[model samples]
Target: MTRKLGLAGVFLISLAVMNVFADRSDKEVVKRVNSIEVVALDSVEGYEKKYRIPDENLNDLFAEKIDSLLNSWYIQNVFEMPSGGGMQDSLPVVSIPDSVYIDRLQAIDSYVDLSFNKTVKNFIQLYTQRRRDQVEMMLGLANFYFPIFEEALDKYDMPMELKYMAIIESALNPTARSRANAVGLWQFMYGTGKMLGLEIGTFVDERRDPVKSTDAAARYLRDLYKIYKNWHLVIAAYNCGPGNVNKAIRRSGGARDYWSIYYRLPRETRGYVPAFIAAAYVMNNYKEHNLQVRYPDFPIVTDTIMINSYLHFDQVSAMANIPVEALEALNPQYRMNIIPAKKDKHYALKIPIESVAEFIDNEDAIYAFKRDEFFPNNEIINPKSSNSHHVSNISGKDKVLYTVKSGDNLGYISEWFHVRVSDLRYWNNISRNLIRVGQKLAIYVPQGQADFFASVNRMNFAEKQAYKKKTPVTKTTSASTQTSADGKYVYYTVRRGDNLWSIARKFPGVSNNDIMRWNNIRNANKIQVGQKLKIQSRS
Candidate 1:
């Protein structure tokens, strides 16, 4: 029975070999021995090469979105709101004494130097009284973003206080874009974002992906700490870049303290450290500042699923009864609202915890639902179809140029223009909806309507109000249109559940395009039920 025993031994070894192969996480294997597989010698090397940051130069997009966002945070938290109401209604403003501030500073258990000074005190005022409402709002959002940041920081063994740095960088706005083209909550520029392994492409900018970017930021911070060996100097280096920090050090005769090189740093960088300390203090003791600590309404529980097939957001929305807007908000990294997963390469799709089962139950239907409507012919939408931001020619029709105003995003703009959000990005070369207030964008419309749009845009706020005054009755025909008192334009009073897209469908030859063009409207979603809409009268 020696031959039988030999066969049994071989079978047992084969099972052991299968178990060994199952334990490995790498993608490819070369050969199998008795109870182990020989991994390809270059497999690890190939992975490092593939995942390493590529050496390439990219042009930066200049915009004031980030500056305006930061400035608003300053105004909201450092200046009193116009309404006079504050968190400290019963308490005297600026009541904190120097001793109290000093004690609080001394008590802070942080690796970063928490020094009490005029700069820090000024920021404290900004956070406590002047911008209490803004501080409250930041606190609300912090409930959602801070945990993600903390998790990454913990993974890298970095100090948790470093989470406050994102506050100074992006005010917790995941899609925040800076004037220097730095992007995301961390405000990473192209060179740094790319080097940190953030994928920046036509469809996905992982820098805007909250989870991924925070991990990258944590890794970068750990690397910076390794260089400076001091959190304060590391913070300065982060803001001004290593080169600028190095120069500042030389200018200060090789000083390591942030305060010593503060004057030599960039003007913005000078305020950065103080802001970080203020943010940390404000976040920790918000109740003392009379700020409300409300939890954010954002989905706290989410599940990420690996998707290996091409899918459009509409499919998931339609099959799972989730709003497309909700999906877009959750997955902002997908620039075009299209997840370009291929059979060979997989992408992660995150969904709310409650809806995970729904998504899974209807997975097949979601994949096949109206596939053509979302992505036609499997071609990725080109982000650079238009060279200029103004005057797009769609279907050979002339287009209008609309300047983005504050409080505008792709959703509302799409609703306002009766154009798909995808079309807006394709026309403006915009990869994300993080638009600046002053940026101009192209809107295609029927010919000869461009001049009308200019007149609409030129109208003063008072004139626009007068133009769109609502009436009591809803009309079903063009005869229902009301001429403004000045007789220069017509108005339609919106009804319940009305939107630019739905309203545009009601009037013949009066698309959302014409309404937005004639009214200087950009965000269609901003139209409320009782709001009035200006339209060109068919009568």
Candidate 2:
């Protein structure tokens, strides 16, 4: 009866006259139920902007939704510099002679500029001093990512030092994006990625796939090098585009030298070459600066499975016991957490190396699990229009405003307000997970619940700041949960505040990876409070 009612509701909603731009009716009608006034979504134009999600939000949403179910699930953690910190505070400047700098540059086998200029020195200071933590994290990630980068560079016969460009492009984040919409570690724009034979579709965006995008970037760099034959100019062209570099050359009276035409280049591009040089230097000499690599506990080893039929992340998570978040982290190419399998198309799903046999053994069961929930009725939209993502809310609820705070995402905010992510997206008319600090968001809820948000809205910024600081976030596990017997599996019941990262830390020899593999725990949603987790002791 419930299923029939749901289908009937879906049918009735589909029949309602609507346009791609909005859910609107021509006449404004006031609807009141139990003395509560409610506004229909279509009645307001551009109402979705009230809840607008940013383009960079999907991964954040996935992370927030899952929490720390799997240890170190980030496929590529984007390296961003600390907003404020100084070189004087962290490390002292060591005076090295100009001759030593020149000799070091000469000893290097790279074609790119290794010259010790003021610009290069400034960036070097920025990395070794102001951004030490970011650089240290980059060094840790470099251990895993650098080999892949070197392979691609070697395959294309490019300079090995060119690998550092990924550091500048995206800080080695495969899912990195610029405000201009350039994407991935290589930061390829849509046109360039498409031209390089990268497949981008509704279901899959290959730009977010590290291996494929790195190959594309290598080819692009090689092609640019072919034209200029100078690595510095090639790097400049890569940043500001070939047209701008060419214009800079013309402005400098056809000067081929990067430094000679540097003044004519874009302001940001001027810093680009220097930063690249600094990145290469820092990666090579991180230990000298007292920086240690902060590597993730998750192993680099993984295996890929070919998925020919439609596969949802939830199916893989439930049947294979791989956390859905891990799957998303490994296969970020799949937007909407969907591996759309057409009859003629094949998709690749990567999982931890240990989970391969289990995945195969349960392949049939995975495909058969919850088919209806994963692939529901195809929501109709105007494929031609950009502003076509619209969700209809038949349940009349009043909209409330919430101010976004520091360390907030859609998932966290949704949980706090007791609202669905879909509803948050629908109210704001945004498709992605990105929201900004201090941005106001519109949330719809019952009239009786209006006071809750009203109280939140009444608080000033300073009051909110104080409240956030007063609330302690870190959770600790009991000492009893820490000890495990050798050659046996111990079961620990999940607590309300427990996450995989914390759980792994409770046992000395155990890691989140071990827990993920042993219990088939992958998705954050799969693990709940009071759930029993299997812990295999390595001791």
Candidate 3:
């Protein structure tokens, strides 16, 4: 009987150890899932919040948020592949079915695989202390973004798992900026966003709007899939563009495989598809790495209202009893507090579902408040204010129409044209502190102002050319200068706390590459806080 009891005790101890291991494995999986959600969602929120600032502060704030999100997400997501052990060993192996394998093979043949190489692996591993820690940080951020991405993808009948693509492109960071000047979660460039009907101007950038941008991304991906009929090719096209993929296919003698033309693709484009696949794999199986994710503290549901005119976020939040930050998170496309300034324009305003009725009830009051704040100290005229004054002055022969870009404001424009914001407001008859894409304004400048502006632009262009010709191709200075007409050139001296993106926007037609080339900058990570360089004007 003593022997029997001993055997029973041994069994009990074994059972307890198994239970502990099981519990730990479950917890680790949960943690990883939560972390990914947080990273993705927070990135979305960060980008949206940036668009809520005033026009004058938009560019700098946008660039700052983009850089911050990019660095944070990249560090968090890029981790070493885990060795076989721990929870990963216990979990059931995910099998690639024959059909799936066939599909993958077909995709591999069509587009060049740009998987992370030894260099990228070494960089990520050496950069972070523990690979698991990096994974956990990225997973934490995913908690915030997956829901948004899933919803957007679902609406377009795309695979929900495709949401992880943002992790590869922008590390689920909504405000992420790429070396190629791609912006937001989908990493859309200016031209691509415009092609997808995403409006960009001084007042707002729809590409920064989580919902809108996601929708555009979905449509774009769908279109690519339709054209390529292969998921891998679609992803490659997204990274390097369909034009490049077509050229690559031609070069490969019509061999439609990523590996076949991998070496022929552009340096960045080669890694685009591989990074995506690896991200998807890691995100789906983070438990293998012992990563933990922290859940986000917000519900997924939000309310939408159709706004007919300009409205301020502060006013809406006050009326709805919601926090200003929450409102901004919900609607990130608006560059300023005011919506796009077009007559009878319909702006979709998002709010918490509970605040919908309250928002509607106080809508009139909000508009009245905005008008009052805009035209304070002005006596009420006998006649009611015409709607024309509120409408963007895109018409009229004497008017100068300006579409606002990522970094522009009255002050910036005034400085460029030697006018004051007050004068600009008066000349345009703009009220309510609102602006929009395609909105035209009447500038009461002297008759020769255009000519003078053109001449100044020419001089600036010339200065850029001269600088480019003289400077040795150093990475630091090459990245910040641009070529201009004539021998003269214009460049930006990087101020303290300056970033490449901010400097890039200071000049017109100056790309991120131009800045890098002028400054001879190789890796964007090496830029110091106070380095001075040349930049193109944003005029």
lDDT of 3: 0.50
Alpha-carbon lDDT, every model: 0.62, 0.61, 0.50
**Each prediction's TM-score versus the true structure:** 0.58, 0.58, 0.47
Expressed as tens digits, the lDDT of each residue in 43-103 for candidate 2 is 4333324321111112221122112211122432221122231222356666655444444
lDDT of 3 by residue, 1-539 (tens): 00001111221111111111123333231122211111122133332242211111112212233235424423222211222212121233343332332233233321223232222232222212223433454575575567778898788888776776776666555656665678777888888788788888766788777878888888888877666665666777777777777677666556465545555666556555545544555565455444454222222246678887666675675566554444555565776655754456687887766567777888788767646544334322211232333422323323344554434456555545544466677777766646664565555434433433442233332233222111011134445554667635665555553444334434443444456656777544357755766554433
Ranking by TM-score: 2, 1, 3
Which parts of model 3 are misplaced by more than 4 Å? Answer: 1-67, 70-144, 295-299, 341-343, 375-539
Tell how far residue 10 is off in model 2, in angstroms: 54
The true-versus-predicted C-alpha distance at residue 94 of model 3, in Å, is: 21
lDDT value for candidate 2? 0.61
TM-score-wise, the better of 2 and 3 is: 2
- Clash count, predicted structure 1: 5
